[model samples]
Structures are given as C-alpha cells and as structure tokens.
Target: MFRFEKYNIADWFSFYRILAVPLLLAFVWYGERTLFTWFLLVSYSTDAIDGFLARKLKIVSARGSQLDSVGDQITLIMGLIGLIVFEIAFMKANYGLILLAFIPYILQMIIAFVIYGKTTAFHTYLAKTSALLQGVFILWLLFFGPVYWLFYTMIIIGILETIEEISLIYMYPHWVKDVKGIFWALKDDRRTIRKKTVKKNGV
Candidate 1:
C-alpha cells in the first residue's frame, strides 16, 4: 500500500494525472472528443502545477520525479490516442512524417531503458519545451484543426530533444535527474566524479 501520509501536496497533484486516466479513456470510448481534450488539458495543467509546488515547497524527491515522468508518459499516450481517434484523417496524411519524428524518441527510450533500467527524469529545459509545445499542439489540433506550423515545430523540437536525451545518456553512465541540457551536463559535478573514479580505478 502507498504511504499516503508520506506523500506531500505536490505529489498528490502528480497523482491527480494518473488517477484521471480512466475518465479520459472513458470519454474516448464514448466518442466524446471535446470532453477528452478538456480533461487532457487539466491533466497537462497538473504537470506544471506539481513541478512548481515541488520547487516552491522544496519537497522534490527522486520518487516524485519518477512519478512525474510516469504521469507525463501516460498523459502523452492518452493524448496521442485522442488525436488518432478524433483526427484519423490528419494522422493518416502525416503518418510517415509522424513516424519519422517518433521513431527517434522510441529509440532514445530504448537506449535509456537498457542503460538505466528505467525511463529518465532528467527534465531538461529542452524536454520541458518539447512537452509544452506538444501539449499545445495536441490541444490545438484537437480543438481546431491541424496547424502545420505548430506540428512541424513540435516535430523538430521533439527530435532535437531526443538527440539531447541520447547524448545525456552517454554523458552520465548512471541515470541522473533534473539536467538542464547539454551545456549544463558538461559542467555537472557528477561527470567530474565519474572521471575521477575512472582515473583512480585505471579503467
């Protein structure tokens, strides 16, 4: 059983997204596109809220980061399902480009899992920008129609973020969290520690 007592307020906000998945799915099942999209917006909103509260309240933890990533993945998947179901024509039209953009992300995920035994929670600035744009694009596409500019922009940022994630994976052999980006990682003490250890071990 989860120790609810130990979970802080920000953690509860993170929990809100996971707990709301079923309702979003139910809306999807019933062909309620608007309802699903609206609920998804709320879910995405909680992502920002949780992160802020975690920072302001100074209750951040490894577990919270893990939960945040899990919630994010679930929300993104649900959003994609919504887009596919509601915008089949758009998806069909851009399936090739979509796959091209998504394949790198899938590959990056595979690399992370193989190396770290879990998905990363680096929360790099690029990752945050990618997520923000993605959420906006999905919501806009669902609410209005496909905006080619936004779609293409999301694709490019997403690919760049994937490349950065892959690079970070190699930079830190062990998983680390809250990395800002490549430049920040280069200056991170963890890299120095690893190098010193490697030198001491002569390996």
Candidate 2:
C-alpha cells in the first residue's frame, strides 16, 4: 500500500513531519500527556531522518528544501506555544524568556521577507546548530518544565542567531554570487530594467 521508493525520501519525511504538527496539537489539547510525548519524539526524529535521506539519496530539490524549512519552523513554533499556554494555564506565571527570544526571530523573519522575498536557506553550520539547539531546548522545557540556566542559554543563542542573520543581509552581495540561480536572477532583472529604460529613451 506504500510506495515510498517512487518519491524522494526527504520529501516524504518532510510531509510526515508537517502532518505530525496537528497530531501533536490534538494530543496536547486533549491532555494526553503520554501520547503528546510520543508524538513529540516522533516528530523530532523525522528531522534526522529527513536530513539523512536528503544527503544520502541526493534528492535535495528546492521544493524539498522549502518544505523542510516550513516543517521545522512550524514544529518549533507550535512546541513553544504549547509550553507557553501550559505554563499560563497551570503555573500562573509568565514565560518571559520564550517571549523575549521570539522578538529577534520575528524581526529576522520580517527582514528576510522584505529583503530576500523568502527566509534565507539554512546556509551555514552555525545557523543549523543554533536551530537544532533551540528545538531541543524548547522541547526539553516543555517536557521537564523550564530551568533558569537553560532559559538564559536560549536567550544568548537567540542573540547570536540575530547577529548572524543581520551579518548575512549586509553581506548578501558577496554570498549570493555563490548561489548561481539567485545571482543570475538579480543580474537578469537589472539587465531587463536597463534595457527597457534605454529603449524608452530611443538610445
């Protein structure tokens, strides 16, 4: 009944990862703690599976890359939201650190959209490690409750990530050249506009 081999394994894993989000939500909302934990583990495991399949099978399509990014962000966001809601409803206290860390990420997302039209690809090793750390740390907070030192660590990492993205934006000209398609697109658009202006001027 399953035809996994016919499709890219990474794509299939990414799809499953996205699908798990709603399942996780339902489990958390219904107060099924055991089930929610299992779902979280499964969802997190898919991260490794998808990365491995992409590297091993060499099927890293742009679509797969986009899907992987969406899947990751959704997973992390939902997990944090769940923690915040749980804390507020049960503990009657603020999740101040999570809220603060979110500020730079929100700014980064906005800058990415305004500057590049999409969130930049997970391009550097530091960026990837930061993401993984955030995800694992958030999940740990959810399952075990927040620890003061860990929250501080997350805040520091978030600051570093913000700096990294800002640096990337300022250095885009140097970086885009390595990504041939983005380079070509920028060059072609400039050439097209110049040609149009020259034609209009009878030059």
Candidate 3:
C-alpha cells in the first residue's frame, strides 16, 4: 500500500501541502490563535514527511521538487506576514524593526528567483536548513513572546546562508550544472531499478 508509483499517492501529499496555505491564512486572519498554531504545526510536519517519502520511495521528480519549494515558501511568507501584522496591530512593536526584518526576507526570495528562476535554492542543503530554522524561529516568535537575541541570531544566520547560496551560483556556475547532472543520474538509477524489478517478475 505504501508502494511508490510515479504521480500517484505520493503526489497527493504534495498537493495537500499546497492546500494548507489557504487554511493557514484563514486561521490566522480570523484570530483563531489556537487553530492557527495547530495549522502551522501540521504544515511544518508535512514538509518533513513529503521529503522523506519522496526520497525513500524513489518518487522524487523535478515537478515534485518545484511544488514542494513553492508550497514551503507560501506557507512561510504568509505566516511571517501574519505575525508582522499581529505585532503591529496588537503589540505595537517598532514598525521600523519589523520592516527591517521584512526587507532581507523578501530580498532573499527576489534574489533567488532572479538568479535561479525559483523562490529558493531548492537543491542546497544549507538553504533548506536555513529556511526550516527561519520558519521555526518565526513560529516561536509568534506563539511565544519576542526572544530578541534568538530572533536576531536567526536573522544573521539567514543572511549568511543566503549570501553563501548566491555566491555558489555566481562564483561557481558549474554548481547548478552539477545539480542537473545529479538529477539525471538519479533518474538513470531509478530506471535501472525498474528494469531489475521487471526482470525479476518475469515481465
């Protein structure tokens, strides 16, 4: 039942992740803090499950990767925007500081898209970890109170991570080329496995 069939059950999980964005927005917009928190938790959990299932089940495809990246960004951006609006509306925190935090965050997305034609460097482990940590940190700040030191620490780390990723694209153009090569290699490996399975089944 858990078998990986290309564009089958596994793809539904990807679609579910995408669908969570609107539900998350609704919860936050309605000021249902409890419901919003639960929604965020579930959304973050699915990020891990989707990646695990894709890799372990050998269902990783370019389309799946693209969908996953877009979904993650949408979830994160909406959450951050909601938190910022909440802070301004309720807590009356410094508008300048919030705007300061927002500028770099939006720049990261813009730069990635302009450079890589995507919202993120989806293939980079550091990029992924940076995004995951940033998401967690943002959620922590929203549900809990402001941990100023922790928030600033994550912001710094995020800036460094973005710089490192962009540098790779500029300094080593071949790095992205290498990623394409890796994808082809993975596809070839999958094809080999299918062939072996077919032979064993006497097809």
- Cα lDDT computed for each candidate against the true fold: 0.92, 0.66, 0.64
How well does candidate 3 match the true structure, expressed as C-alpha RMSD? 9.6
The window of 10 residues in a row where model 2 has the poorest summed lDDT is 173-182
Better of 1 and 3 by lDDT: 1
**Each prediction's Cα RMSD?**
1.3, 6.5, 9.6
Q: How do all the candidates rank in terms of TM-score, highest first?
A: 1, 2, 3
| Model 1 clashes, total count | 0
Per-residue lDDT of model 1, residues 1-203, tens digit only: 76779889888888999999999999999999989999999999999999999999999998899889888988988999998899999999999888987899889889999999999999999999999999999999999998999999999999999999999999998878899999999999997898899889998
**In candidate 3, which residue pairs get closer than 3 Å at backbone N, Cα or C atoms, i.e. clash?**
none
TM-score of each: 0.95, 0.73, 0.69
Candidate 2's TM-score reads 0.73
Candidate 1: the clashing residue pairs are none
Error of 2 at 69 (Å): 1.1
Name the better of 2 and 3 by lDDT.
2
Task: Please give the ranking of all candidate structures by lDDT, highest first, separated by commas.
Answer: 1, 2, 3
Q: Candidate 3 residues 1-203, lDDT tens each? A: 55455464556666776788788778767877767776777777777888789889987877677667776777777667667555655335545555565576677677666766765434555556666776777677667867777666766667765665555444432213224323343454444675577779998
Candidate 2 residue-wise lDDT, 1-203, digit = tens: 86766568788787887888788888778877657766776777787788788879888766677677677777777666566555554324544655566788888888777876776554445556666777777667667766667667767777776667666654462213112233344454544675577779998
